[model samples]
Target: MPAARPPGGVTVRRLTARDARALTTLPPAMSWIHRTWGGPEALARSGCAWAAFQGDRIVAVACTYFLGTTYEDVACVTVPDPRLQYLALDCVDALCADMAARGHTPSWTCSTSNRPGRLLAWTAGFRPEREYAHYAVGAPAATGRAAAG
Candidate 1:
């Protein structure tokens, strides 16, 4: 698929192992990639990462994880620059197209609290598949009981 051409001179391209350092510059919200995928090195090796470049700096990134023979889970993060916000959707679009060509369906799991992410997913033509609650198990509460209880 052809890359997205955002106005204002931004360029989008696939990210590789060489771009690991750039991944580090992403905001904290995107740090989950490091924790879940074993940092930029693993992400680079996944052969499914893409980014938007503004000159020598990385302004946005999108990646996919193959869940099975038929589905790929997509995620993305972008700099807070409003002028460049659209870049995230563009990157995802490119990734989705690439996935389709390879016979894998692209799917997105978005946080309801993340309005921008929801918007981006919708703009990229993703619709709600199903709804499920997400829970995090953290340190014990002061009473030493399960947080849910």
Candidate 2:
């Protein structure tokens, strides 16, 4: 299926090196564009990412953040603005469609508390497949596991 049409005044396209500046404006929580893809420079080079923009401002982005044996981990975020409704969905739909064309299954994950993300995934036909928890721990400590000989 063709991707849903983005909202008027919003345009979606493949992420490029020029977007590095706009990507920097995202807050830490939306830093997946950095942490997962090693910043906009890398993501642009990967050619597996897309962004929604209103002129020079990046309003949303969807990217394959991880690659498993048979699926691509999908991540997306939109600027926090109520007026930008449907913006993220449009961006995600376009990205998912492109991934499908490339034969990559998309795996989307988000904290259960993220209602907006969940809703967007749902709207994009993604259903829950598994549930897991992640923790932010301090510096790694070595466990006393003897090496197998």
What does each candidate score in C-alpha RMSD? 5.1, 5.9
lDDT (tens digit, per residue) of candidate 1 on 41-62: 8887677877888986788888
Write down the TM-score for model 1. Answer: 0.80
lDDT of 1 at 29: 80
- After superposition, candidate 1 runs with Cα above 4 Å error: 1-4, 136-149
For model 1, how many clashes? Answer: 0
**Looking at candidate 1, what is the lDDT of residue 15?**
82
- Provide TM-scores for the models: 0.80, 0.80
Candidate 1 — worst ten consecutive residues by lDDT sum?
139-148
